[model samples]
Target: MGEQQIPDATDPASVEPEPQRGLSRRGLMGLALGAGAAGVALGAGGGVVGGIALGRDQAQAATDAVAPASGIHQPGITTPVQDHLHFAAYDMMARTTRDDLAELLADWTYAATRMMQGLDVSATGAVGGSPEAPPDDTGEALGLPASNLTITFGFGPSLFDSRFGLEGQRPAGLERLPAFLGDDLDPLRSDGDLCIQACADDPQVAVHAIRNLSRIAFGRATIRWSQLGFGRTSKTTSDQATPRNLFGYKDGTANILADDTAALDENVWVSASEGPAWLAGGSYLVARRIAMLIETWDRTRLAEQDRVVGRDKAKGAPLSGGDEFTAPDFAAVGSSGKPAIDARSHVRLAHPDNNGGIRILRRGYNFVDGTTDLGRLNAGLFFLSFQKSPDSFITLQRALSTDAMGEYLRHVGSGLWAVPPAPAAGASVGAGLLGA
Candidate 1:
């Protein structure tokens, strides 16, 4: 019943891991690297695009608490939102066939499974693999524990095109998101054919997951865009407190809890009755990179800010009055002969009471991307939401079209993806859809 632990990087007990079924690789395993191999790796720089040493030593995952990776659902979706995230979008290579895609998923699932269990992608990790070739893992985390890592994968709308012969299997509800009110979308950062969301308590672990995965995808797929985020803006468990967004407002205060199976089934999981059998138990993932205009909002009066969010900034309580957890009394009126909570307030607009009882599971984070060229702080919220159908998110977003808070926000990037269920043991992700 005690917590499971992984072998240390230098442990002699470690041995080579078998390749997942149908996963054939070029390099040999279990051959120790020599001084010359070390020398070669030292000369290599971190950039894979350049001809440098990537320091990719496929070693055991040095981690602390381990997060279970194999389950009915993908790990990061309902798992307690981690403290850091490394999210990347990828596009399948040109002229690639269905087999290529399936192989890629198989490889990814194998590596992800190992990493989540606090092991390297392969058994002969880091220095244990043939030293002549590049290491299977990027060795930055050799001594680090898994740090409760979770890797979640998603298939974007583009992947369902004729190229994969998945057109007929596309769900009726899966499509590109409609244009929102204040969208200033960046084409380069917008959509992709696939995406991977890596989250962990330790930032390096999250980054390491994506780095290794991207390396695995060298010939088959390329990264479209990626984002690093910290300071979770939402929680999936009741034990976690409501985290704040860049705006300093407590975000996702009424979010669905991890233990609320009833709500999760209703709002997050796609049921068999929903159709498109391949994605029956999965959910739709919607990501929006929302750039917050803090300078403008900072200049606004405090009282006006409360009116905009319909909640007291300090207590995170409804302006109509109660504690942080108190449901907003949207019907209450202020002495000014108007509703206490502004008509366009975010709380009222996004509340399930106002949105036809529709709710989405949020897993967002605050981001500060250094500074803009103009010297202003480049900061915002990386909003992530999971729902049974895309329509739920679209409806909520549409209701916020004229939100008073809209004046201080701009959505720069967006993507909608179908998050498939976790693969069964020894099977790769999307095996159901790929017929693997």
Candidate 2:
């Protein structure tokens, strides 16, 4: 990403090609006119061919994208937010020993490294393995590119209670989140010993990573709950535009950017001086599956909706007036001579100015799990945030207890996990914590 041009997605060095190349006749034209492609794509004669060329460019960009498995911090938290997510929580199998937990991480790290590079899970992959037994790799991702895949691991509060001699090392603030005012949390969908967050530009690539990782953990652990999300709700870099939630409001308008090192240190990354040594440079992750009542929201008047969010529905600007990025003028008065932004509005309550300058990096997604029994769309924001300490999130959430926007939402699934820093290359994730 620094200076190198993206290599082709189908390059032999990056991916093991399948027996058949999945290309259409129009795709052949895109490959033929590769260099001066854009102008030709928009040409009068090239209608559908133009669409194919655009698709080609996106694929090429994804293939060239790769987040290293080893870094000062894990990749997904601060990586440019991918388009899709496959998040799963796992409970360790009964009678499993500490060694089993350590080995599971080692196996996951190895496979993640390969998949992130657009390679198979192992050298003897799906087709290359023996014909009798199940394949090492799930052959689904065979001809696909890496799609900027990242797999992040985290440990939950329940995992540290003397089960594996980790009780003494638990971070002071690492506990199950206290119940908030509007929580209708489902026990089945909440909490696990471990969590894996897999994100990628391609849905298939994201799903394949989780499927393969879960396969690797077959004996040691099993999935407790999982969620599939599309249309990322937050961005980790400045280049991305603010995305809208199901309520049709642009969310994460003030999210932390990947390049803000000072902000990262202050708000996102855990410091060794502030936490257990093994968790240094890592962050705490809070996952809340918030269900939005879009039908009810859709029927609400436009003016009422604007008042609830404290931003103009059309421009996403502060009610006090200015552009979308303008800092809110909480003190400004409306024509009626009242405070322009309502005190109970979501914006004013969640702002850093009002919360003693608190901020968290958000990398969430929008989810639709199909129709509920009542025949309403079961859809909402799969809210995910990373912070140095869980207290930052708790404080902000408590501040939003009276939020007018909370009326249209429900917190159905929740989990809090302490994300550890990326392991050294070729080392198991959480090795430092395990003292392995």
Candidate 3:
């Protein structure tokens, strides 16, 4: 299949046009005064706050531009992993109609498009809006740059229930994942009716996206769980150096790359023949919040740590030798008369060779969320993977059930989502499903 084209965000035909030169301080002051007047008018009639229009050329020029939102596939997955992440899952409120859900998606798409370009959620934006009324935007990201923001949306199995009348359209591969060994899942954080992944170089920018989206979803949905991550744990492109996990070992050396289009099609995007036609160019997302036992791993001997991960700490090379990208010599034996790479080591068990040549695109991050009951640093890897089917992840994870790395980690949270293909110009994300 041909790759879908991603429209340019600066294209006037694709996005709402902003002032050529951007707004000045004087222009902003005048707008603020006008907004105050509008606020008074709104307060008299109990209406939404109104605001003056502002331009975004200044903000756009301040930050790096990201991949366009419209594409064959969504941006966050293969768009060079950002430094920060704000991932959220939501449950549809009871009694929400199909129209209500569709409208929410449209609103979200519009807001996301504007934010990705360094503009506020709406033209009036935060400070320009009525002072007496609630601002349309949350105002936290007022002066921040776009920071290469990208927001990707997905639908969960629960979304296809009678509430939306989409039961017949649910993909065959969309189903609740089977429980795996060592899973200590929290029901409150595990599953949801929908999900959004917002990534940016700046943490505040990413947080702003989710914050505003959740605000927009006030009555239609409620946040089930959310996670904040920093210091990306995986590399999605060849130019980027492999990042390390909380364990201090380099991660994703063997991960699929953005330039590997053939591998991506075979392992990531769903095809029309795969079952659901609407999901033709889409992929499935699997997220796991893994808690690493930092204290224990810190005390382990260096050699043992290397053996557990099956790679050299300094060079990230396989036990059997060669650089980081060299294919592991799993068949090679060591001086002790055993396989150089331990049979149960992470590399041996998770390698595609052992799992029928299955591969996944990993976009994970390191997360530190305060502390546990014992006052231990609550840190771990927020594992994120995208593939054509959840079966790919399930198959690999099951094989790793006996992996030595499991002892140092715990699967505390999990989710599975069907990320639809990117929308065409003038269409919203998931427009294929909503028929908008």
Candidate 4:
């Protein structure tokens, strides 16, 4: 009945985790690395910037005070395996009516908070190695989530309407950027309706969160549109700590380190966007989605599939040897004389130049569900990338999209939003863009 507290990473008594759902080594690796933690940091910054409130409740009273319009109920009637759940939802915007803005935002904030509270605490903000409980160490030691929910909000040209004197709307046919053009994109809810880009560890939770947020925006906010996300199968921690994707192959063998914030800023942020007065301190565009296509992916053989991904299925090590993100010797050749890491593999597709010239911050989740008619649901990823130009993500994805592995992946749901610079103290959310 009291305010529910996140389990301490070190306090076993506080961790009331569900049963192990076959934690994949890759999944556990991804979560432990704080892959989804960015969203929490995004929303919770302003007492809960993006959509998460942590530290102490008194300090985050504004964030903790709000509850979602409806609770997120898990799908399985019986004890569900933790790894089976996944979700990735992000969005872009279009013009909205000015009169409807306030109401829409209130609903959105309320819905997001409630939905977050609805998730299994472990999945939401609490970081854990297994589904059943939190790891023995928490807090500054690991930066585990206070909940599984990870939501990020951003503004785009469409969020503002020219009719109201707002000047950010995109022209027709080009309103949304190339990266965000897709079938599953969310519609405008209102002129002032804040754009939401969210991802969860579970799909049912993600869907429920989206739907409930929609109810609030449409019913009270009078916002005109909304978007939902679908993610691809990713590596996740199962009960056994084995790594596997929807296609059953290990994923995320190649990733930047979590502590590498400086590297993230250098490699991912767009310096050009910061030059403009209105855009100063603003981060570049971030468009993301969940892609689900494990069934089609499952048809390939392990050996052939490994070649396409360029990593060992069991260990998540690069074909060249060490685990993902570890440096690979491009000059090294295999027994047949071909590069140990295929010159054309996904790794190579991303780093074709060989100086490690290209990089994008990838934060994705893994999802699976029995209720889905689609075969063996396993998908989850925030699918976020920041750059000076939309071309950064576009260029990299273009390189990989036509490759052998690209054939196995599809973009099911998508979003386009801007992540401005960190807010100054006392600055309101979206202040950098909205002018408070």
Candidate 5:
């Protein structure tokens, strides 16, 4: 959590560039221009180009917007939730060295700083560079505002392998998550060596961030799996309204708020006393690609739906409560002599009070990827949470294993990552661990 001066952005000494690839500068520029023209032409018939161009113009007309890229903690963790998200997991190539990994982080940090400020990745930018040279940035976001973009990076347990001589630097608590009941996890989408979370108010801005970063990692890393999400399902700040999930129920009604510093320190940030000095102020990220069985849930009666969630759908209030934020009277009796809120309801089972008083910062989003092979809608919540320790999540999930709501949900893809503290003003992410 110590502060240090960041290198001057104008000085090329701040970050080491990757070795040039086979494409000559002139050839790269020519190819890039050709691609740009083709994209414009493709958008011409639908008026897409005009629309986006207008959007860019409008964005530029406003005052420049920015999100601080450095602080005591990463921006995306506690920053107000954005409307769109682009989450990607990557695997480092076998031949990549420790130096390669360190340089990549530094380069990423520099680019992130510029992008967050509404500038291009490098001085050459998307256009106006040498006619033959490859453009430093993809031009899609050329006319867009910063849209409060924040890019957060994390290291998975797999990254601590012999390949990078980083085996000893792994945090003692970083490990593959334990399997839970009813977890139908797919190995292909389950784990990765590293991950990046790009969030912004504009969908295009979010996509562009991930696209450019992936391009930067060309030989050193390859994307394992990625997800695009919209309609944020949770709010990190008190000012934002709680968003709903695919189930049509308001989600994250009682989530941790950005202004709740005390709760955040206790539940989200790791202290130096926790050990692994490098992770101080850092947090653990848990992502679950949960697929909702809409058909089954749709067939159930409204009464049963309310019972399953232990809340009134229309009001999002506890069945035995006064309102949305009212404490659930778990012991209240119904007119029929049964417990008002069922003992196995999701709210009761997953409540922190029942799970050793642990809470997590939820930053999830809703997703829909067309239809499944069986003709059902392939839709669900991309559940994301950050916590001081993985055990907090582990304990809460174990209690939910037997919750009635589990019937309509399936855990397909999963990942756990160690999110390091934010870099100093001039430092790149992971600088502490990499000793860059």
Candidate 6:
């Protein structure tokens, strides 16, 4: 396969064109297994965000990365970018290997840095937006390969030492990891050790970068993990969709929308616990994670499952309407007097207040990697969402956790961060949130 293209967000016609096919398989395989290439200095490869020049120096420092001396072999199975992709996995550090996880993470950053160097780069959204624009395609708009990219990184508690081992005190640097901001590519956050995510218009390039980095990290790290991605259909397109997670449900229904006043305001916050004034333009507090329970979930009856979730299991439509978010007629109950949607269904339980309402913008993807003890695993969504407060998301999840929906679901991994808002002109990524 050449490259599976990412679908466009706005006018589908505006997406990238496509990549040329057939890079000899034998050559690609050899490159995949070849030794690491000489290191190349990594920096902003000349890109702009919101009309501002994100300098090469700043970009390089943001990721603390340098390009790979050489590239890897191209794979035939180029991943596709769907509406969303999600993934979930047990943390290896939490289970057994705690001390060596850092080395693994270091390698992850290194490999990822290399992979990104090969992508079609551009910046699509303003750090905080829903129905986010795919990678910037200014290059394509100008009749060149789309070059915009958006990469965000998140570190879960499991990545830290305290959560990794049974010992009383956490290993050094693990605690500090939470405060280290890898690449301040996102507008909302600028704290945390280093969690680097790079996006590009070409799905093949993006997938290769991610998988290569992840595989490199796996080679050195001691954590059990999973990943979800949206690869481009071809080298030319930038349109991308989020993937679904193991639960089979589009997981990010509760994320904050971008470019919306309500969303921007909701994402803004003040907390002394978060450091520095330079972090003002940022929104540093987002809890991102993946939950997997499909095996258990798949066993439930479709009708019963629909009732429990308050939506058509297959169509994802609300009890009374056309689609997932469509208005639901709560009064439409069955002759048996049972609510058309169970009173405690995930949806019903989540949006208990018809007036106050619950809203979350979900950005997730689907994934299928290696086989597990259970069987061959199919995973996806890189479950991510932004909320004004944990209370909103928590209240809803708490309800689901205790209800029938919780039976088949399991919280496999979690990552919490203080995401700062994007900065204004001539400012660093989190200038506003950091009070810079």
Top TM-score hit: 3
**In candidate 3, which residue ranges exceed 4 Å CA deviation?**
1-4, 11-63, 68-70
Tens-place lDDT per residue, model 1, 223-244, is: 8999999999999998998988
lDDT of each: 0.76, 0.76, 0.77, 0.41, 0.75, 0.36
For candidate 6, write residues 1-436 as lDDT tens digits: 1112222222223222222121122212212343221111112223222212233432333321222111010111011222222222223322334323433332332223323333222222112223433221212222222233333433333333444442332122223222221111232222232243444444543444444333333322222333445531111112233223455444333333343446434433323233334222333223333334566667877777777667775666776667755656777776677677677677666663642565544444444556567784544234444443444455455455446666554344444443333222222222232133
Candidate 4 local lDDT, 110-194, one digit each (tens): 3343244442222233444456754311223122232245444455554545644556433221134554323344333221223
Could you give me the TM-score of model 3 versus the true structure?
Answer: 0.89
**Candidates' TM-scores?**
0.87, 0.85, 0.89, 0.58, 0.87, 0.52
RMSD of each: 7.9, 11.6, 7.2, 13.7, 8.0, 14.2
Backbone clashes in candidate 1 total 15
Superposed by TM-score, candidate 6 places the C-alpha of residue 196 at a distance from the truth, in angstroms, of 3.1
- Tens-digit per-residue lDDT, 94-127, candidate 5: 7778877875676565555556656665556788
Clashes of each: 15, 0, 0, 75, 5, 101
Name the better of 3 and 4 by TM-score: 3
Q: Is candidate 2 or candidate 4 better by TM-score?
A: 2
Off by over 4 Å in 2: 1-62, 68-70
With a 3 Å backbone cut-off (N, CA, C), the pairs that clash in candidate 5 are 6-426, 25-132, 25-133, 26-132, 29-133
Worst 10 residues of 2 by lDDT: 38-47
Q: Indicate which candidate wins on lDDT.
A: 3
Stretches of candidate 4 off by over 4 Å are 1-96, 106-148, 168-175, 179-194, 199-212, 219-244, 270-282, 285-293, 323-325, 352-356, 367-382, 421-428
Cα error, residue 337 of model 1, in Å, equals 2.3
| Per-residue lDDT of model 3, residues 1-436, tens digit only | 3434654544323333322222222223323332210000000111010011113342234244554443577778888889999999988788778876776676666566667767676556787777886666668888887888988888998888989989999998799888999999998878788999999999999999888777666666778899999999899899999998889899999999988999998999898888576788889999999999999999999999999999999999999999998999999999999999999899999999999999999999999999999999899999999999999999999999999999999999999999988765445666778775
